[model samples]
Target: MSTVVIAPELQKFLEVVRAELSDLDAEEQREITDGLVADLTDLIDDQGIEALGDPVAYAAELRQAAGLVSARKQVRERVAVGIRVHAVLDAAKARCRHVLEGLPGDVDELLTSLQPAWWVVRAYIAVQSVLLSSGGWSLSPVPDDSISGALALLVVVAASVQLGRGRLWPLTRWSGSALLRVVVLAINLIAIGLVPAVAGGFENREWDNYDAGYSDGMNEATGAYAVDDAGGTLFASGLPVGNIYPYDAAGNPLVGIQLFDQHGNPIQVKGKNECVYEGPEEVLTDTSRVFFPWSDGAAQRWNVFPLPSRIQGADVAEPDPTAFTGTNRPAVSGFPFVAVPKVSLPGLLTSAATTPPKAFVPGARTEDVNLVESGC
Candidate 1:
């Protein structure tokens, strides 16, 4: 005959009772819970889990039957919650176990083996709670940049593992004092409840960094990075280069530059680029500024670099459909940079004679090439 082991659910049920009776002496508590594991397993198998009912109520009845319920024990530090709340929880727990027990596999041992993993998770939740309270939590599971952070994390997790294994101080004995046990259980419950909120904080922080990492470099000290959402426009790094600016090797800002792709197709930017111009006002003493986009006349050439802007009171028409007659604000070219440091262009790559690149025919298919006649 196979030896019977106590189910994990039953063990959890007994743990709750043990916690409730934390005020009692170890010897008496042991007398109550000791050999009942096998007995209750048989009992539950015989009459279904309903036979055991609520573990809290059963503990109370057992204490009363054994004459262990003293007046002082009745009102003891059970301030955690009353019997009814515990009974409801016990019933819910039993229902969950019933559902799991019905599943067609060895779920009992599967859960039993996974208990250590929960220890690590609970420890992380505890550490995150502390960091969150300080209002500086980071997205990384281990957020410290130095060795101290790693050491602190190790200490916390090791303590938690020890606590879970019942190898720590008071629990190393039969149990700790009632007040200490109650406080520990309350802390664990708080950690469990904080999982969703902690996860949300990390997710929000991740997206914030992603969005800010790609915006205009004016707000950030760092240069702009290219983003994937530039809509077929010119991008430097990852940011959309709204208008192109070029510099000669001597660092002088060059104008009227045009760009093309590897296929010799003109590279055009699809989005609008608004340019601001400042000029002396005629009627007022203060200078004025105008917001208008300059273009290469009616042709609307976007591939041209350093597109110019018009001044406040120039002869150019107000930015509208008719404003594209000719490039306006010719004298006031509003290039973002006057000069930029030059960079060396890389040398052109040459293909190996043995492994030439594949020839690309614009619109020709394999069948079209096959049907073509060679030189006569």
Candidate 2:
């Protein structure tokens, strides 16, 4: 390559300008200096040495013309800002350390010693991320009793621990890279985001164990599970009661009786139009017979006592879902008991009628036999 020679004065001026601009990034410096040697040679050949002027002022003018910052001023401003930030961070860190150290029972040391605990936490969470990403909302973070789950947890936890200890692949080789730091931060955020779901999953984990119309401790009769189990159900003799019967002191069936637990939660049930029955000591067979559940003017309320029953007939306002497609079956629902005998009235409720409020006292069965034998 042939060298283009320049006058000593012009060469000296370019060198001085380059030196003044040393603090700018390489690309910015190259933008100002790329063709300068040849351009400066031509300029000096035309306008004698007087056009060169002071090199520092020339560098500043070139930077301004190119829309770049004045390098010396930028360096000074950055260094001053860095010093302030550094001092603030150091003071804050020291204050935190002092406050922690002053707390009861070596709090600072305890936190430092708990680094491995964080490793365990993040390890569980990292494994949790895979499950969450794969379409599980309510699930155990560390799934138990399964080889796939246990092995995944073991592998992730070991990797997470090694990463925290700076011994894993990316940690050992590329810890200083900004992209790697961002990836690590994103992984941490995802893990934190799944924390609530993991907790909720455990709280309602019985649903996960449900199978074939049976849940934990469920009997074949009255065996069913609901999400947020107790919230939407009533229990009698420790099993789920699908519906309740409420009879008045006169043995009259009551409908639309809003019931609640002691906690004041509205008792509700799932399933749109669940099959239910009535009549004491009757064979509880499901039929096309309908029950008109109460509506708070919005949706059907199944918890209302004595869900009124009738046969499918010509008067139902809505179509039957079980009917053939595009045709509404004639389904009718009505109050099953509009009237009954009164206990307080003369001859209305005889002693032969069922006892009022329908609860048997202790040994009432034996007493009933005794009364029948005595012919009272």
Candidate 3:
């Protein structure tokens, strides 16, 4: 039987434990090291590398279990400090909100300006929830560019509304009523101005650089080849069809070929415009392209094309004389030709030249195509 090796990080942790335990009774240290090794090995065998959350944490836990007082105290102090910091931030936020409630004029605008401050508190609460909810602590979720842009837009709006109201309130109380209206209108316009820019920012952050790769398809007649769910593998004759080539609409050899599935679906195959006698040397190189069932996102779908194949004993220029015609010529004059000789071959091979696989023929009704989520 083969032995599975422990990861280097785990091995180093064991070494550190061994060093720390050296001050103990010789036999006791050996026994502790052996037990720790056995426990770690079992953990690796069962749960894999995920058994260790963090190397330092793992080491600290092991030290505590082995009765190392100093290490245990250090870990406890770190945890206590973190808890206290979170508590202080939470109290500060509560105080700020209470103060906001007593202030006058457009509470919504004031709240909007104070959102950033509230988020700090909200993030702290979220972390606390994670800690108390049996999952332990987790960091605040990273805001995407879209979220950041939205927040920025909100801030601008809040500032504009506050400034406009402050400027117009005094003017409206005086004789300059028209000037006050103009200020109010200007504030609204400036707030509206953020809409298009916010929309553009949303588009840029979400979709600007995204390029969904090709779709997959398969030969209708021959169901011998297909791609994986992610279209990374090319199965030919129940195996990977190693040779892949892309062609343009004019049938010229291009860089990458679009492959199809058994259901005549086109799949995407990524490649550069370079010719190699060998087949696809890289399969599933990018994590984004890999087909993980858990993450069935849009990027997983592929578009594939058919690669070139060799015709046995046939020259490129000549027609395949082996093709069965309806009428066979008699060997001699007046000799009867075999009547309707059976051709023991695969599906009907039409005399028509090879071409790209047919595109998907969508059903007449939108429901048939399963456009709605209810149908799917």
Candidate 4:
């Protein structure tokens, strides 16, 4: 038989097949390599070597097919992960929407009562700014919460303006209709009451005390003391203590004293001494500086003690001792005591009772107290 010369292109293809089969068993490698050579030769004869396309392209296609199987498996795994992530995100979005929609009708009712005005404008701006900054735009395919909040705020502003203009209870065009007027007035009253109740509930539910002292009591040599609007004690001497330490409203801590009761209750003593430097020691030098002190004293000592007589009355909590700090400052300042009403008393009692007591000893299992005593 005449010797048949292999084309340069066919030689190249065989070389690639040989390299790929190098890692296979000798028998398998020979079988695969020979098969590849024969197939390429037949392809070249059927279509000119050039027409069969680039040798590298053909080799690349084979490599890609082999890798494609592995790649497809990887793609399936990635798709599964993506699906799970999407499902979780979808559930979260639905829950968020439900929460926003479940807001009390009073939220909308209050908005309806508000009269459109500059404060309303400011309120809308504030609400929108909050929503936008909180990722309102990307919340979901539809921004349900952002839209609802905006609409609710708008209604409130409109109602406020109407109430301010005395248009809330307009005299009907029908003359001598006292019955109509009375009915309208009653409806308006009910609506007005509902607005605040709903808004109040929403605020109370969401507003959490940021300071540890506010939520839990501070431990001292004597015992655990509750924090009030005033703050916590800093030193063992009963000086007004703050986490940031001794900074007044102006960021300056004058002469201060901290003391602890025998039971480990921390007491804060502030303000400069009088002419004799022996006058009555004041608890706070300024009203803003006065905080609730936790003690084992009677309920009256607590801020929420003493229920008020009327529901519409002011809170009967103790006034801050540091409220006024000028020349007329009292020798010992404390919050003005107020009466607590049933509505306020129930909440106060519930909070106090539910709150766990602080631990007396350090490293104890107490949930309420985090004593960072100095020199301990």
Candidate 5:
């Protein structure tokens, strides 16, 4: 092997190559650098460094030839993949910088030239503030329906006003007189802070009232329940004065259904949706439906009521004393009924004309007797 003396400039060029090829493995980097040093040592002796062109650019070309990424490009690509969010932000910043750089002058001068567009943004922000205060408008950068929205408006107003006067800060405007600027700055801060607080306070008041109204309306719709066991608890077929429609295990309507009591006598629902003894003159209201103790014994109705209507307590049909077996015969004193005034009058008239009279008064056995007699 011949001894080769590498020149300082050639060594420096090889170092640059090493740096450019740093993304490659140590063994791969050494192989590329050693090959380049061996070949380029004689080239440098024959032709000066100038003939080889810029070292960095030459190193980049060499890196590409070796199927390796250059140091700067590799770093950028790695960062781009690793921090995708930052990459997007950097692209946006670069675009903005390019747009600003394309303008007639530098940053401050460009801002002054594009004053009209900035003012338009400021004006739009101000209009949004007015709408937000009135509870009519909301958008991003300022969270909707939040106290922070008011604060955001104040900040935008402050920045916009300063920008309109070709200044960044209120104090900087009166920079010639430090004391005067300080006083004005303090006063401006006070005004900005106070205005939003006061405005937002009023807006908050309106929203608070709206929320409270909805809450109170819900509370009023669900009336309280009351039970009076006057007749006794046990009955044969129909439920106590409150249960509107009775259903069996199979969900079949108990109306006109025959059921036998503990004594095994055939009990038939003759008419009026109540149970009558086959052999005797006694009438019965079914006591099987018990009040759920969990809801403070509150009565429940189906969600059949139309919305935007109030619910109120209404008087039910008076209880019959002779129907039940136990002394704890319960009566539903009040039923929470939907009071849609628009529908109630017409509904009541239709019900009165169509519904059987015995459905309204289950205690009346005269109709049941006539039905049983007719059937027999």
Candidate 6:
């Protein structure tokens, strides 16, 4: 018996199919793989190879045809889900290419067949070109109103003219049409490259937001440093409160040194005028903490000065920075007397005798101080 040599590509393809059908039991897998090797070993032609299409896709088809159960349901589910997702996307892509191909004749024919309707089609092509070249559609719903749009329109119109005159798509006797085509090609290439860039930008933005929150939380849990007015060190909450800025007389940003509170906590400064101060840990409630009727606002102190109007503020009481703690006290719900539990009323409401001021200190008066001036 003569030994039959299998093509390397065929071998590789067979291996991939085997790997994809890993869901089948070991015995079934062996049978399928052996049958595939035997059948493919006999044939070696582009037609035979092309007939298989993608190895992965072929494996899925074979599995379905054989009614073979997957060894791992999770793997099968993932693959099936991926196939479902790609089906619509791939179909849409094919549809777009078909549409582009269906458009009227090449440059030379387009010039000769220039009709009122053809011009409208040309305009649509121009708009689409601008949109693709600029990547405006990727970033926003509306097209960017810029020079890129103008350039895209210009290139498409020129290409259309060349195509109308019965010449090549981009080259009209090596004239402006050729240059315009190059530009259009460049724009398309750049836009395609920018797909990853735009995606990366979004990813980076999300990461930055997450990192900032994490850092703020960590800082709040730990303590921060600052200096007092008398230049003494003091312990303070690690949480950032606000910023401060100091500049030279010439208005240049001064760096190198950081400011501290009277407590000796080191103040963090970024750029020239920007400063970050430490404060209390933040508080969050599952429900809105606001009682609109009684509270003019909630967490009003969170509003940093010299900035835009803040909608909400920080915690009213300083939070325990070391760890997250829950209160045993039942949350006070609803408004005033209606929501208050009658059993807890006495404990909830402070006694009037203890609540009122012992001595009503009216307005400030010089007579109260009884200051005497030295005879001058």
The best candidate by TM-score is: 2
lDDT of 4 by residue, 36-139 (tens): 65677777788877665655456555655544233444667876876675566568657866665679765544554553444454444444434455644322
Best by lDDT: 2
Model 1 C-alpha lDDT per residue in residues 85-194, reported as the tens digit of each score = 55655687689788889999978678879978878788877776677778764556564446676677778888888887778665677444444455566767888899
Candidate 5 C-alpha lDDT tens digits along 278-299: 4466443321112211011363
Model 3 spans > 4 angstroms off: 1-147, 167-177, 183-304, 309-376
lDDT for model 6, on a 0 to 1 scale? 0.44
Writing each residue's lDDT as its tens digit, candidate 6 over 99-133 gives 66677756444544554345434544446544555
Better of 2 and 6 by lDDT: 2
Between 1 and 2, whose lDDT is larger?
A: 2
Cα-based RMSD of the predictions, in order?
A: 24.5, 14.4, 30.1, 25.0, 17.6, 24.3
Please list the residue runs of candidate 5 whose C-alpha ends up more than 4 Å from where it truly belongs after superposition. Answer: 7-9, 19-28, 41-53, 71-241, 245-376
User: lDDT per residue, candidate 3, 180-274, as tens digits?
Assistant: 44544454455355445444444544443342111122333344656566536555544444334433433333322345559886554422111
What TM-score does each of the candidates earn?
0.35, 0.42, 0.19, 0.18, 0.29, 0.20
| Model 2 per-residue lDDT tens digits across residues 172-260 | 77654444555666766777887786766665565665642365456334444433444465444444443455546665555346777
Name the candidate, 2 or 6, with the larger TM-score value: 2
CA displacement after TM-score superposition, residue 185 of candidate 3 (Å):
4.5
Q: How far off is residue 248 in model 1, in Å?
A: 38
Lowest summed lDDT across 10 adjacent residues in model 4 is found at 305-314
